[model samples]
Target: MNYEAFYQKSIEKPQEFWREEATMIDWDKPFEQVLDYSSAPRTRWFTGGTTNLCHNAVDRWLPTQAKTPALIAISTETDSERTYSFEQLHSEVNQVAAMLLSLGVKRGDRVLIYMPMVAEAVFVMLACARIGAVHVVVFGGFAASSLATRIDDATPALIVSTDAGSRGKKVVNYKQLLDEAIGLSEHEVPQVLLLSRGLVSTAIVDGRDVDYDTLRQAHLGAHVPVTWLEANDTSYILYTSGTTGKPKGIQRDVGGYAVALAASMKYIFSGKPGEVFFSTSDIGWVVGHSYIVYGPLLAGMATVLYEGLPTQPDPGVWWRIVEQYEVSLMFSAPTAIRVLKKYPLENMQKYDTSSLRTLFLAGEPLDKGTSEWISNALGVSVIDNYWQTETGWPILGVATGANGKKVPAGSSGVAVYGYQVSIVDDATGAECAANEKGMIMIEGPLPPGCFQTIFRSDQRFIDSYWKQHGDRWLYSSSDWGIRDSDNNYYVLGRSDDVINTAGHRLGTREIEECIAGHEAVSEVAVVGVVDPLKGQIPIAFVVPRSLEHVADDAGRAALRDALSKQVDNRVGSFARPSAIHFVEMLPKTRSGKLLRRSIQAMCEGREAGDISTLENPEALQKIDTIISANHG
Candidate 1:
């Protein structure tokens, strides 16, 4: 069915709709109520049900698909690869589950995972789910202080890490970083399981640290039963940096999360039982937890766990993997596509990408230019989806060609089944007219797969989201957006990032998109800086298609003027950037989100807050130099 029909039926009968969707997974005890909203902000889904996420993702697939490949892991820098069948994955999960139990880990205990994107990391996550432990995954590159903040907040009983992690060509000493974080945290972790991926030179604590491989070997052949948890039982707690300078833990429930992710696999991704799916996301992020680990496995498909960047060895690494594995569907952030766009078109022609069916982009606002470029480069349908960490799955996405849906270039499509998105005025919280820009809000009770509450901060959850709309009960997405005449939703940048220039408000995304349309520009970020006349004038930092242009002062100046003209024509003169600086790269998070705040800070000659999440810290100094020279 197409999205129109599916969405109509879902909204018309949400209770019956979600209840029917819950039957897709295997449950030890079925739910009595499909949704419960008596507690206002803390809405519960599939109440009165009992289920195990590990059983649904692994054990149920073992009998019929025992020999089928369930996971494909690729290491880009080392050119190493491995595959695991459903039977093998189940056995490894059980072994690790047994090991966690031996270490005194029990139901509802928090287990922090700080490792790279490896097969063992996936196994550890599933093992924690199997034993009913709430897993907390911190990104591998996070600094000790960042890790310590999460450790103190969650107070995990045990921490799982690796000796080292490889990204691109650099190896991060994860064990050493974990040690520093543990020392920094006030909370006392009882045990640490260190997986020796390569060397054993890292110092291990006498009583607290244990080798993961040794523990797994000792627990080999042990039988561990899956723990059936209530529908409201916490499945995982993922920490996300908030605007308030504190990391907030997002809590996901067992039964509802599994049901929602399974449904999303079928509807959003068009994934089948045995198709190969690859989502280029690290296991630390929410996308990895849903699409990489749980979603594909729940759909009974082979999920690719890649431990490399898209442009690691060359620009053709991702396409080569697609051809090698015959990947049917792929999902990635727009930042990767923008980076790949820098290479010549001949680079993509070297590999056969015919096996790739549909390409999905998420995690940030995708510009129309980048979306069209990727579609033409890969010769496949590219779809831009919209969602957040609080929402476990996609709230907005285009349907695949199989569903007879037209993929819009820049729009995030219509709302998915079971979600009601509305554009409302920021001041009054009143619904806006069509094609009018306003704050994006989702009317609740939110569907399954959405977060339940902020960990240990019910009031904060209410204050941050619900309180904004007063008695309306709308979940504030904190994003600015516009709904077109055809019901297509276009996400402007974050509401806070909107620039006020000469009494006119403009979105940074619009200016960035206009500048990115230039042939010489590969990626662009626009931020507002204090101005004497216009209050705050927009300035842009652009990455040229070729570094040679950046080295040539004359070429850089000419290109900047051309980009300014392009923005003025597409948007308005008020939206044109006052100054444009050609840079080597833009600061970004590992998950591919542009660190606009960091750029804004650099422009104002101030310290960027909490830059520990930056994927390339070295780029900040370059940005500062470019901004200073241009301003002078």
Candidate 2:
């Protein structure tokens, strides 16, 4: 069948369609049903099936792919490289599993992972899967407070961390942050496993901390078998920022997730076994979980786990890996591409990227300008996809599918199969007209591989996702999107205040709260401003309790510097505001609601539209003057 027919079958005959697709996965016990939607918008796919993610990703491929390179790990920060064959990976994963067992970790327990882009992190993840322990990976550089919030939520049985992780020449003290996070959390962990990178050192906490290598050495040559799980059993939890100012843990299931990723590898990426796959995303994000680690390995491809910035050690570092590994498939983000646009093309062209078949970009909207430039420069297909951390996979994207869909510029392509995607009116929840903008809605029963529910909160999942638009049962993406005549979807920015900075979705409320915590500030509004690079950046305007703190220009500068550092410590450095201006008042409406859109518009030098209800005109003018003076 062609792409349209394939998609129609998925919608019209979901039972037959999904059953056929489910064959791509390796299930220890076949499913009795393709889908059980009796309780949907909460669905359970491939019910009655038993499967192991580790077996599909590693052990099952051993007979055929054992000798081939399964994982290639590189770190420019440490100037090191290592490759593990499928057999080697299986053995190491087993060793790590044994180590976890020794630490009292068991099936269904949670292991909080705090490490960088290192091979050991991958081993621990696979090990957790091998023994059915759910792993929660916090982004390595997040501050103590952010980490502490996740700790209290997941309350892991164990924490796996490293001494430090390097960014450029600077080393981030991972142990310090983990120690602080543990101290702040209400839950007490039983054990902490440490991977001493020796890049930096810290005193191990006597009774709690244990050396990772020592445990691995004791369990060397051990074989830990896969722990089979029912299809609907929870696999892992990933935390994503919500408007409520706290991160929500997105729960994923076992069998359905495996089948979804298997189909993605074949139809979407069009990657073959023994070929190389490269994704420049940290393991902390959903993309890394799906593409960087699971999907490629399940397809029997060699996946690269890379560390270090794309520009560090020169812009050629990424391309060098591509040329060296002969990476056949690549996945990255638009923000990274935008940053690369500034550098000379020769930095990329010098490397022979002949093996690269397709380059996929996601996490943020892909603009036409950047899309066209990168496509022409690489002389390859640049496919853009759109999805959220909650979704766990793309909602709208282009792939080498049955129809060989033609990508329209500035759009994220058509909706993938199994998604009953529609552009709908925000207030009324009615479907929109052709070429009209609306909230992207999924009718119900979110496709396989999508999040099962919010961890520890079934009601929150229903309220936050299913019934976001009041009484509407549709799944609101909470993002503004427009559909073309051919059904190509263009994702405008987030409809809410979540800011996508370099593909990291940060809550504006989180940053504003961090800024407001400053004793010098009484009120603050944080807005995401447009950027030529990095997609968007946070900008803050603060109202001080006393002008004495910023009585002069020099005083104001000092206050700004202080607030910037405070955000760095309270949040992560990536969340630090690009600029913070001390203002006597923030622009507000007659109802005392802050005019965040107008504030953002002024920062971007755009027209502030429909401000008749704006109560304070001078407040906006003050911001305009501040922005103008900075540019002038």
Candidate 3:
């Protein structure tokens, strides 16, 4: 296949080009048109086409290169490694699928998958696909109550999980959580498929559940092999990160997902056959579904899955994995970078990371501080890629840098082909000038891989994204960014995180950077707390290098004054934090981004649900104390 020719044609006539690309895979039936944009935000792709993702990702590859390495699992602990060839993966998935069939799972039935980064998790996902079951993957760290809510909501026929999964040296007991979560559910409970990694002696079995090993043995000779399905069917139901209310399940089709994913693999990762592409994000996140699973697998490249935090037993764990796997492409989050930076540089020097080539960052706004450090310390060029769960792949990325073009440190590079990117004022809905901050909206008929609708709430999806600026353009992102005269885009923080005081608009990230510039401050989180005087006032939660100084009122005042001065010099007086809470730590998500909402909730003395994802949940309690002492 001439991928380059297809990409070039896709840029010219996307609809027609995509129709052609859709034919590359085996389809149960053909479609009339590649796309129909009759509806604004909820356009359908491959209008009448039918194909299956499992056929392309696993089944097709099984016949040609079954002996080739398909997956590389790197544990967070030092020197934990496992590799599965296409044949091994095929056999595992086949056995799992047979077990699922024995348990009465049928085509189109939903399956809820909740597990850590273990290789069995991937095998389970593949098994679901093999048998035409729609799978929903929940992150392993989610609170049991939250996990149970999703399971009850989706009402899947089967739930697959492990007794325990290791993260660094810490063990997550998913079985206990699973039991507690489903204890109160009145809905029909799904049959449990359990994997006991190190808990063989402690295995708990029930009439409604089957042990993973036993299930595999029962299907040893019952392997029916993976078969192809139609493309237009539901591939999987991925629940979005629900910060608002209940997480909305986003249903994606097989054909569109496969086509859009192939483009992303080619253009975004510059992936070629047999290349090793590693992403640090867990399968729970959307990036993991696209880049880590479907995309690389469809491109005929090897995908590496890291099962633990970047800093487990040591800070150099990820670097060592890259050297050991010979990973050519690496993708991770900015939060991981910050955690690693806290470790001694000497620890990182012990590993050889020369195999890494292109480095990509996503999930949150990448600060220049981390970007520079990655480029200088790792000796790999860093590229910032932008996309949402709904956008499918890299709608905007630094594509030219695939050849080593040095883009300015902070820019997300120019818009990739097939996207019309612009920054516009929220109130007026007009494009903003160069260097002016505003909402970033992509003008498009909804592309393939974009979500069809927010599972049960069509109006919510429309109200959240489409209805913002008339009904013509789809507004999928809440982030703010600016384009320079050179047409390079620099992402600011989220629009909701933008602080407005005394007629001046300031980004929380800007204030954060200024506070971080101070020698005494270790880390900072800026939030617009409710105030009677100003509509909302910016507050700083600081993590000081030395608690001895920060614990005192005088020292706290001095540091606050210094941070105020720095903010004024860097951005302006309006951007300066009105109050600074010198605390032991700041609340953050597991992925490592500071949680402004958690801080806001704590400051307001409200509940912060599911702190299970936090690397340090206890940090929030300390923050609450500091907030109360200051406000009281």
Candidate 4:
């Protein structure tokens, strides 16, 4: 079906539409009510159905496709590899589930997973799903303090982690961090199951700590029945950083999540049974939960789990994986693509990446320059889709297959079926005309896969999202966007990130995109700084392709002037940055979102609020030094 037809049917008769879509999954008990929106923010989907996500993902395919490769695990740190078939995956998940059950982890209990990107991590997640336990998978890189905060909020019954994890050349003592986090929090975690990766020494606690291998051995022939749960039952709780200091746990439901992800895999990624799909995201992130583990597995496709960075070992590592595995579809973030862009395209040319059919990107805005460069370099269909941790799958994208349209470069395609997206004026809450910029909102009753509620804060969920549009119940995405005359949406930066200078509101993305077009520039982040005359002036922090060119004052000045001219020629002088500072790196989250707020705070000599989410917190110091040397 074409975009308009599918979207029209979905919005017009959402109940009927979702009912038909729900048939894709193997539900233990069919849903009677497709939607129950009698309650506003506390919306319920497939209220009466009972199903187990793990069954649909693994067990249903066991009889016929038992030997089909289910997961391909690639280790970036050691260049090691392993593959598991559907039967093998099912058996492992059953074993793990039996072990969890033996440890008193019953249905509805929360289990915290703080492990590296390993095959065992995937198994742990599936095992939790199989037994109807809510899995809170924390990113491994987070410090003990951050983990403590989550542990306190989640109050999980058990914790699962590896002794250590290797990221590139650095070895992370995950168990040590977990131990410290447990010590910091008042919540008593009764049990800890540690998986030894054979990389680092681990100190096991006397009464609580248990080796994962020991549990597996004891539970060898045990079988744990999949816990069929009501559709509205919580499946997972993923913590995302909030505007306030504390993180908000976004809870997702089982039945709706399964149906939504299965539909997205079929529609958005155009995945098919036996196809090899790869998404280079750590299991800690939502994309990994949807695409890497559950989505592809539910769609009966092989999912590649890469345990290293794209540029690890060499810049050509990503291309090598695609060629080696005959991967059909690949999804990654814009930052990863930009990092790859810094390396010569010749490295990609060495691999025969003919099998790669579609490339999808999200997690951050895909700048036009990076999109164009990767499209040309890969010689495949490259598309940028938009979604969040709350929205389980792609809310916007040019889906693959006959129904999909040609992707307009840099535009996150039209809204996916079941999502009615609108660009609305912030003040009036009225829809903006095409080409006019405004806040991006999703008119709800949001479809099944969307987050049901903030775990413990229903009021916060309402206040943060639902309250913004008043009684209209629009889910405020907190993003600025514009729809072109052609009906394609261009997501501007966050509404707060919009630069208002001399009565003109400019998106940082527009300026950054223009600056990125310059040959010397590798990456760029533009922030609006306070200015007495212009209200706020745009200042850019740029990472040049080569540091040698900007090693001296004269070189820096020449390069700045050149970039300024490029911006002026591309996006007008009014949009040009007042000053450009060359930096070695840009501060970003682990998921690849540039922390513009942190940069703005550093520039203004204020506290960069809650920087625990940063991938490299040290980058903030370099940013401060650059701002001081340039502006002071």
Clashes of each: 0, 0, 3, 0
Q: Identify the runs in model 1 with alpha carbons over 4 angstroms from their true place.
A: 242-244, 401-404, 468-471, 548-551
List the pairs of residues colliding in candidate 1. Answer: none
What is the C-alpha lDDT profile of model 2 across 144-259, one tens digit per residue?
87888899899999999999998766788999989998999899988999999998879899999999988888999999878999999888998873222466999999988888
| lDDT score at residue 483, model 3, on the 0-100 scale | 89
- Residue-level error in angstroms, candidate 2, position 36: 0.9
Which residue pairs collide in model 2, if any? none
lDDT of 3 by residue, 1-632 (tens): 34334334555698776776565566667777777777655677776666677667777787778888888887764346788887787787788889889889898888888888878888878888888888899888787767877876788898888887765577778888887777855557758888877742343646767788887887895575554555567778887764545778777777788887876776567777677889888898789899888888887778898877776666787787777778889888876776666567777677787888888998877777777777888888888888887777776676542332345776777666556578888778889999998888877665677777766678877777763456557464788888888778877788888877877777788788777767676677888877666777898887776777667778878878888999889888888788887776667665566778878777666786557677677788888777778778
Residues 1-632 of candidate 1: C-alpha lDDT, one tens digit per residue: 66688787777788888888999999898888888978876788888899999999999998899899899999985578999999999998999999999999989999999999888899989999999999999998688989988999999999999899876678888988899999999999999999998843699899999999899889998779999999989999998853335679999999889999998888788898788999999888999999999999999999999988888788888888899998999999999889888887877888898988899999889999998888988888898899999999998887552263674688988887888888999898789999999988888878898898999988888888774456557888999999987888999989879999999998999998899899888999999988888899998988999987767878877888888888878898889888888778899888888889888977888888777768898888898777667668
The weakest ten consecutive residues by lDDT in model 3 span: 1-10
lDDT of each: 0.88, 0.85, 0.76, 0.89
| Candidate 3 ranges with C-alpha deviation above 4 Å | 1-12, 20-30, 77-79, 200-205, 225-227, 400-406, 468-471, 517-522, 544-562, 582-584, 609-612
RMSD of each: 1.6, 11.4, 3.2, 1.6
What overall lDDT, based on C-alpha atoms, would model 1 receive against the true structure? Answer: 0.88
Any runs in candidate 4 off by more than 4 Å, and if so which?
468-471
Tens-digit per-residue lDDT, 479-535, candidate 4:
999999887899997888999999999889999998888889999999999989999
Query: What TM-score do all the candidates reach, one by one?
Result: 0.97, 0.81, 0.91, 0.97
